[model samples]
Target: MNSPDSAAATATAFDKARTGLWVSLQKHLTTVYEAETAFAQAIAFAEAFPFAASSASPEQLDLYWQRRRALRDLFTDETNQLDTLNKAIRTKGYADAEKKQLYLLLLGYMDIAASIFERLHTEVPKPLPKDDELEETSARFERVRKFARLNVKGIFGLLATAAQ
Candidate 1:
């Protein structure tokens, strides 16, 4: 566990780009979490109201493909950002607990985001979830998501407050 002072020191020691990247990572993480929540809600909505057609119309299917493509693009972009972050971490000489923050960002958020892209990309004609499943998914991810949000917020605050 990193102390607040260490966090402050770490943030202050980095150049503006490094600090800004850290904040961007936190914001991206929050977006990832919110995206997951929205996805679950969409599933729940779909479960309640089944699609009118047994199969999607060409336009509808095209829309799905477009969304999947967009998600893939976003995931690719995030991965590039993560590569930048990893290099920055290594360059900063952060060891021990300080490095753990990267796991929270790179794995907790980015990995999950990537998995979402994979799942959507691999969806067969209608890979629908069971009606009851989304509730469980929401419950399970919410706790971890909240924890991540809090820690990321704290870290960002510490970083932002640090003197340049």
Candidate 2:
């Protein structure tokens, strides 16, 4: 029932979609890491030198707040990009079942990444430091580890499916 041309067209579409998804994901990840590093530095700075009016300048404290705001803004921008990518994928028509499944899995993964960013935004110390900061940090690392494992498995699955 399937013509060679149609099959080729489908393959092209699938490849294009996959590339877009992965590129978007990579950008999101880079932003996440940058934000995380800035966050950790801010926290360390705060903990090391308590912001006493006598000890620290108003300008120094202002710089810290500025960095925090910038990180929050970065997350917001990333969330918007992810939402746009999600919409594009959802609107696209996937004719092949295997390709569709792969697309759907990727869409789900993007959603997870967005959720992680949302959590990161909320947890970003608007005020800084709670008793549970350490616990939260540990949990975050675990989540990243699990996500990394999923990424590896997903890539291998895609390769195997393509090989067939």
Candidate 3:
């Protein structure tokens, strides 16, 4: 019963949705790369000197804290962007195919983020150990990972139903 123009419009919508998803995915990947770099820097710092040693300098402590703060902020910004992108996708009417594709892209990024968090948490450097600091970092990483995973999964599920 669908008219030709309606079918064409639907195809256009799908294209738009795919493009938007691609852009968002690229941004998310960039964020992931930044976070990975920061993690590597942290590990390097931890390995270069003993954080737990009594002789650890105040400057060294500050530098380490600064790197962690910067990385955390980057991830937070990325998460906020993803939230915004999701909202946009929901509000903008698009073909079912497009919506499903977008949802899948988001889900994939969430999975990647979760994987990165798990790896970081499990493979943390053993030297220069500060239990409290490590715990805090791990907690923050898990928090973001959980939020992204839950939201993406929910949206993907909704899109799946819509597509059907």
Maximum-TM-score candidate: 3
lDDT by residue for model 2 (23-112), tens:
766776777777766755654444333344334456655655666566656655654554454445546676435445555555555555
Query: Model 1, clash count?
Result: 0
In candidate 1, stretches whose alpha carbon ends up further than 4 angstroms from where it belongs are: 1-11, 14-22, 30-54, 126-164
Q: Between candidates 1 and 2, which one is better according to lDDT?
A: 2
Total clashing pairs for each candidate:
0, 0, 0
lDDT of 1 by residue, 48-71 (tens): 333433455566655555554454
lDDT of 3 at 49: 31
TM-score of 3: 0.61
TM-score, each model? Answer: 0.49, 0.55, 0.61
Candidate number that wins on TM-score, 1 or 3: 3
- The runs of at least 3 residues in candidate 3 whose Cα sits more than 4 Å from the true structure, single-residue gaps closed, are 47-57, 117-164
Instruction: Report lDDT per candidate.
Output: 0.53, 0.56, 0.61
